[model samples]
Target: MKKMSLLKVDKLTVQFGGIKALTAIDFEMEEKEILAIIGPNGAGKTTLFNCVSGVYHPTSGEILFDGESLLGLSPEPVATQVIPRDRHAEFFCSLGMIAGTAERIAVNLRLFQRTEVSELFEPFGKGQKGSSAMPHKRNPILAENITGLARTVRSYVSPALEDMVLWHERDISHSSVERMIAPDATSLCEFLLYRLAKVIAGVEVDEARIRANMEITQGLVFSEAVLLALVRSGQPRQKAYEAVQRCAMAARSGQGTFFDLLSRDPLISELLPPRELDQLFDLNHHLRHVPTILDRVLHKE
Candidate 1:
């Protein structure tokens, strides 16, 4: 099953001088499955793409496509990276929208605003057809390029939403640059995904690494557990708030686990029994809602 499933990257890394941009990154994709790599900016997501697609070779580590190593392949050598499925739809949609809108805008400018194609700019000869020996020669090419670039800009508009997901992460930093890159990344990724899906197989999942990532969220994820326990007991809101806050502070400071702190605190222990407390600490308690949420989304019921 694993061997038939296709293109996978194993331990890819990119370094710039002494700094490691990507540190031993690993990824894989099964045929027709959509995998998204999302993180805060500077999290090495794009660097991983560049390495896998062969635009840039990792300073160290390996990329494999269908059991063949693509470590040294350049962009031109490898089949182009396929565009992602959603982005492909977006790109074509934007293209059609731009072409229709441009024609209408051009008509409006020519009729109501007293604008002509020649009069639109200084480079061309007034009222003359396109000329070969002068600057006018490039105007059509320039206009075409602008039209294409505009379509590119309109695609991948979703990432702007993703960019704003971070509370304090909002800065004009992504705004100006995302103006150009968001479209290009979406368009290019969609293309690559399309081309590679058939030829490539599947991605490798490193279970140990995934488990390690989940570990980092440990005590932070337990905040809801503590809150629910306090609420179910019918305790006054302020009292519950104070107890949870005190334990959270202790946990944050590395004094002890939140559950341990709650167990030791006489007031909280009085409010909840040991069995209920243990249930609150279990990670699976939070995940019990997953099947319900997934069913609602998939069935739309």
Candidate 2:
């Protein structure tokens, strides 16, 4: 009989600057499989363990635990220290709830909300029977189905939480709940997780659509940055807020682009010249903190 995989790693890679700490490592382990990584010093064994323990983020790859992803999840290494063994079911229940949220996010992206200019996303395969539905005749069947399964998994959380409230004599009420929910929730959750992973893997981003949709709001998205810049230039808070809001409202009302309207406004013109105002709307203003955020996440902060 073919053994079920308890742990699966595919195309795992880790890089540090110009050095590759691990390069496309691949392996699988079955339940109770006694496998060892036999290697001398600096052979990436430590790097692999770091990846598993959430100390390091893999540069690229997949790591599945009982068909659910460990690497894709944000780490809570500290929880392992404090969580009692009995809370394993609760942990699984919480994981199910998280997976439900994740699955819905995936569904929304695949459904790819339509904007004035374009649909923002499409993650489904061509094989999906989108032809029969109203979504441009394309249905997000896979993502939607996974969402339903995720809700089923989330349903178990209530009972699992209640399972902790048995009588002081330790009656078997929780035991019976465990007997039924344990297998059902776990089996279903594992399947749900595996399917969610597949959905996320197949997701595709439409750069053109994304950029186009970003323009749908006519640069009003940068209003906050404009407001901040106005304040930094010594504009009073109420005055700056009103100026930015007026410019935003003008943009929404089909006035010329937000920048043009702001430039024409006498007060805004004095506070923010074209060059300075232009800089405020640059997309990089929002992305400047990405590297720091990435570093924190990679370090499990």
Off by over 4 Å in 1: 1-204, 216-218, 298-301
Estimate, for each residue in 1-301, the C-alpha lDDT of model 1 and write its tens digit: 5464367877777889998999878778777789999999999888888777667778877777777888764344222233223433455456445544553443432332122222232123356555456743424332343344445545545554344433343335445645676556556544433333321232223455545555555465677677777888998878888888888888788888777888898878988888888888776887899999989987995
lDDT agreement of model 2 with the native: 0.77
CA-lDDT, candidates in order: 0.60, 0.77
Error of 2 at 291 (Å): 4.1
TM-score of each: 0.36, 0.65
lDDT of 2 by residue, 1-301 (tens): 8755999989999999989999999999988788899899999999999898778999999888988888766655434323322475667667677767767775785558444434543465656556564556545566677777778777878877776654553566777776877788778777877777776676656678777778888888888888888899898989999988998898899988888899999999998889988888888878999999989987993
Candidate whose lDDT is highest: 2
Residue 68 CA error for candidate 1 (Å)? 42
The predictions' CA RMSDs to the true structure, in order, are 27.9, 13.7
